[model samples]
Target: MLTETGKEYLRYVTEAFDILLLGQQNSRHAAAAPRLMLYTLPSLATKWLLPELHNWRACTPDVDLALHGTHAQFDFNTMHADFVICFGEERYAQLEKKFLFHDEVLPVPSPELIACYQGRKLLSKAPLIHLEWVNERRFLPNWRDWFQAKEIEEPEPQPSFIFNLTLLALHAAVAGAGVILGQRNLIANELASGTLVIVDELSLPHSKPNFLAWPQRTLSQPGSRQPIAWPVELAGTDS
Candidate 1:
């Protein structure tokens, strides 16, 4: 029983309200899908895992992610990414740290190289592949430290072929380029498949835990999610 003008006004208001509600609902759905940027050490990338990367894909299927991998020496402060997976406690003052997995490093080489260098002084005669950590603090996984840890004296000459990244060193060892101190987890498939063999049973204490780091402030964000359960499950599973 309303006038035509009144009915027209009512119709307009009803349509506007419906549009606003629809927009609100769509915004909420978009917010539910986390759009994240992650920074990680190149070694992790070489191992085919990135920060919050695998768990996000596995656990939160709705999340959208982008990953950046750099040498473990990357400067976290310079990164515009939302999260970083880095080593050591000295970095990330304002972030929460979630320990992922630990790594044990062993000297590895191609079977051919091992056979060729057999019965020789482990360090002096064999070509040692070296991984140079851009960040010195995180680069202790080398022949010198591993040898020292096993109480083997330092060899006369250091490694002749030094690479800036662990993956490079690993590839070199695989190609029979040299002997590399490698992480068991990263090279497990090769070791299992016999593509690479542990030259020495002596493993160094390069066993440091990998961590997921995010700003503490982001913890309360609507899209923020943590892989607390995933890491616990992954810890028991081999890296």
Candidate 2:
């Protein structure tokens, strides 16, 4: 297995090759309409990206867009995306990165589920849908961490449902599977639409943040690729 340093060096090498070839790629695109390839976390793609796509299409009709989704690290060389939405503050030190946003973890359940629970204690005992971080990402925000943040003990396992993807955990909760300690930004539409409602008042902002990253060549030729313009006002509350 490779150390973290080894992984970063590999990313740098890939980016260097991409920059070296960007001019040739740009020239090819100059012959036709501009196009962009974007890779994003699965949850962000389903909850936010898909809902706001019409606006993205309307805003940049001159550009052709293709989207890809995953919860794992991406190889820019193979993905062929102009930019990627990755979870964490600094995925690539050599590549240019922008702070898009991060999630504020909060307990959300279907309105019907809310009806069965009275208070936080009862809610805690209810089925707790969990986003089980896989790979080396176990340190990412989770219910156990959030409980610690609140200065409370971890709840019993309760044979709770576990999912690798946050989006799936949230979907299960919305379908009344259980209460999910969901990211506010990712579930804002459901909260707004009254499909899912907050069960606990306490909110735990994710220790990690999300970011948008692009090659240096992308900034040099901004006209060739337009990154996703996430709405500032619609951004989820932090506290």
Candidate 3:
């Protein structure tokens, strides 16, 4: 019904309008997309976070997650983050702290290490591995502390292997390198699977508690205390 010039003009306008609509849609998607960053210890990442991360995807398909596993505390001053699962008792006084759970440590060793020892005096002979962590708190839970918890004398210094991260110590224990004071809750899977077992039945309660924390100023802080639900979902934790 239109002349050639008018038809061409209408076609041009239609294409332009479509392009603008697409741009608007893309902008809305970009704005609506949620991105979260979390920092946690290597052991917790392997034994806890990673196992449960799939649940988040199933629950909320839109969220993009960035996870960092480390031994030392992350510097929030420079790095932008949503949350952190740190080993301590409210060390960040200014930051809003969500209490996760306290750590329960017991001596754990691989089945191979148990087989290597025929005698009943297993604790005295096995290589004693220790996790050397730089905690903000003064109390350092170690092999001596574990023995003290059982009300027994600390064993003589045996050949020792020390590691900075708990995951490394867990690996060492699994490899039959030594017995490590393992976090029972953290290493529950290993314990359940029979790859690792409690060498000493005594589980010493750590002085400090694990916390899911974020800077008070972070605008994205969820009203719920779950802090990404990294801790509460775990069994035997105070919600």
Give the winner by lDDT: 3
For candidate 3, write residues 1-239 as lDDT tens digits.
99999999999999999999999998887666566678887778888777777776666566667788876667788878878887774556667776777777888889999998865467878889987776532454788776777776777888889887778888888899988888877788898899998766777777787887787666554322334454565534555
Rank list by TM-score? 3, 2, 1
**Which residue pairs in candidate 1 collide?**
none
The 10-residue segment of model 3 with minimum total lDDT is 221-230
**Candidate 2: where are CA atoms >4 Å away?**
1-32, 152-154, 220-222, 228-239
> Model 2: per-residue lDDT, tens digit, 1-239?
87999999999999999997997787777655576777888778888788887877677776777788887777766656677777774556666676777768887889888778777755667788878777635545677777887788887778689888787788899899888888887887898999998766788766677777777666554444445354332343222
TM-score of each: 0.71, 0.76, 0.77
For every candidate in turn, the CA RMSD to the true structure comes to 7.9, 13.9, 5.8
Query: Candidate 1: lDDT of 194?
Result: 91
**Residues 37-124, model 1: lDDT tens digits:** 6777777765646433566577867766666786544444675666777666467655777766667788877888877754555456
User: What residue pairs are clashing in model 2?
Assistant: none
Can you rank all candidates by lDDT, best first? 3, 2, 1
Best of the candidates, TM-score: 3
Give the better candidate number (1 or 2) by lDDT: 2
lDDT on C-alpha atoms for all candidate structures: 0.70, 0.74, 0.75
Which of candidates 1 and 2 is the stronger one according to TM-score? 2
